[model samples]
Target: MHVLVTGAARGIGAAVVAACRAKQHRVTACDIDASALAGVYAEREGVDCVALDVADAGSWDSVLAEVWARQPVDALINVAGVLRAGVTGELDPADVALQLNVNVRGVIYGTDAAARLMRGRGSGHIVNIGSTSCLFAVPGNGVYSASKHAVRGFTIAAAGDLRSHGLNVSLVCPGAVKTDMLEQQRGDDRAALTFEGKRALDASEVADVIVDHVLVKKPLETYLPGGDQWKGKLCTVLPEVFLSSVEKSREKGIRNFKSPQH
Candidate 1:
């Protein structure tokens, strides 16, 4: 299979690329940081490193055109995203736009572009990297949560629409992962909820599920750690009842953030 993964320079995206290559699948690794992408995968056979800004429609067009010219992409994983932590009342307009553009719009653009080509091919898979935040509200990362909610909603609808075209769309929602993104949230009290997870997931752990399971089974939605799904669902259905627990989790997260072990 030929796979294209955005945000392939680091974190879960990079892990996915490595996992795919380990399976001997052809991969096109894309990232906004072209230099870093090239440094990471340029010398590796069976991996094509491309510079991509997922928020820009034109960039998507160009990247897909070049990729298709070489080989048909069998799977597209939309892993490119951004998060800006701010409470609702003090939110920065720039942060809101950046999060929405990169997280929500980026996923939409990639999914649309890939689905168009896949529709013509008569079969393909689209996997979107979502967040646990989509299931409930995160006080500090409201915009990021909203963006992920948009992704989850859009992925589900897109799965329904693309099924008739013989294409599959899947959304993977994971809790806190030990990545640069999580590290960025460590010091911010507003981002305390993000650290509530007992332990952060390794990027490879999530990638294993994507490549070993999601790509093979093509499930419409999957939650990393499995337990998080039920927790998120319960919170969603009865947020008022869970308010106290949420506060407790936030307190725990703050402690986790401050601990050297975290």
Candidate 2:
């Protein structure tokens, strides 16, 4: 399978590229940072790197043309994302818009373009990387949470729309993972996040879940560590009470994070 993965320079995207390579799948990894992409792959075959920003339409079209020229893309994974810390009172609208542009609009563009190609050939899979934050109301990161929720909504709708046309769609919602994104968020309130100061899951774990689900042809939505899947469901079913409690917990947690920023 010829697979195209974005934001593949580090973290879960990198891990996913590695996993697909191990499975003997042809992978094209793209990222805006050339050094980040270069540092990871010493000598990788069946994998080529492209420096492309997902938020730019012209850049995406150019990259997609390059990808198509090399090989027909059998699968496209939209893993590019940004994490921001902000609340309604202290957040910049531009930051929030940037988050949506990268996290939501990026997925939309990739999915739409890939789906059009796959529909003509009658085969393809599109996997979107979302966060467990979509499941609940994260206190200071309300904007980030909302962006992910949009991803989830789009993934579900894409699944329904693409099924009849012989296309596959799945949303990979991973919990906390060890990555630079979280490190950059040190000062921000992490109280609203699941598992305080505890290592949740690694990028490799998330990659495994994503690859396994894709191979098995699972449903449009797949939540990693299905055991905690109920929490997201509960959050959806009881948004008012659940979100109120989460906000309270986040306020309490931020208090501990004031001086040290941990």
Which ten contiguous residues of candidate 2 have the minimum total lDDT? 253-262
lDDT of 1 by residue, 92-136 (tens): 999999999999999999999999889997999999999998797
lDDT for position 110 in model 2: 85
Candidate 2 residue pairs that clash: none
The lDDT of model 2 is 0.80
Candidate no. 2 TM-score? 0.90
Instruction: Judging by lDDT against the true structure, name the best candidate.
Output: 1
Give the TM-score of each candidate. 0.97, 0.90
Worst 10 residues of 1 by lDDT: 253-262
Model 2: per-residue Cα lDDT over 89-190, one tens digit each: 878888888999999989988888778778988888899999887786677778888899999999999999999999989888877676777666655664
**Candidate 2: residue 37 Cα off by (Å):** 1.5
Candidate 1 regions off by >4 Å? Answer: 258-261
